[model samples]
Target: MRFLVDECTGPAVARWLEEKGHDVFSVYDDAPGIADSKIIRRSHEEGRILITNDKDFGGKVYRERSPHCGIVLLRLGNERGQNKISVLRRLLEEYAGRLPDQFVVAAAEQVRFASKEE
Candidate 1:
């Protein structure tokens, strides 16, 4: 899988994704301080699933109707990198094949999929 890890999502999660053999573009490491709109556009253009903790992206995709390859929105209460990784690990383990073109919200205990048309 290919991923664009949002800067707020941190480098640790990006590194862990790399260790899991995914092609990763870490905004924190690669392009710091880029705008959220550009990040989403770039991720869509590059066919990369975006891993982000930013809730503003929800408005971008749902309300503004921005294009995206896929988006994994981590809505964890913990907000720590390890917790993010654990949620993502479970998400990929169970839903990898179903990810593309979807808006997915992963919490500590559950995963929710939102329709693109919604």
Candidate 2:
């Protein structure tokens, strides 16, 4: 799946996805310190799902609705990027189409999927 990996997601997640043959773009890679609003817009325009860990995006989406491909907010209990990467990969494999719309937000304990109703 195409994705816009957030800055917080780290390079490890991005690399893993790339190895999986998914077209992934990272905020820290091409651009650094970009505003979330701009990232949201660009991701939507590019038809890429956003892979973020920022809880604030919920508010952002609430206040400003953009055509976001989708947003996966990660919250792995372990802050360690390695642990988070494992969870993320599992989600990506399990959730294919269902996620493109309502993506998974990884919390400390479990992963929650929140997508819009069709």
Best model number under TM-score: 1
User: What are the C-alpha RMSDs, in order, of all predicted structures?
Assistant: 0.6, 1.9
For 1-118, candidate 1 gives per-residue lDDT tens digits of 9999999999999999999999999999999999999999999999999999999999999899999999999998998889899999999999999999999999999899987788
Q: Against the true structure, what is each candidate's TM-score?
A: 0.98, 0.88
lDDT of 2 by residue, 2-70 (tens): 988888877888888888899999887888899988888898899888888788877766555555667
For model 1, give the 10-residue run with minimal summed lDDT.
109-118
Clashes of each: 0, 3
Model 2 poorest 10 in a row by lDDT: 109-118
Error of 1 at 9 (Å): 0.5
| C-alpha lDDT values of all predictions | 0.95, 0.77
| Candidate 1 residue spans exceeding 4 A from truth | none
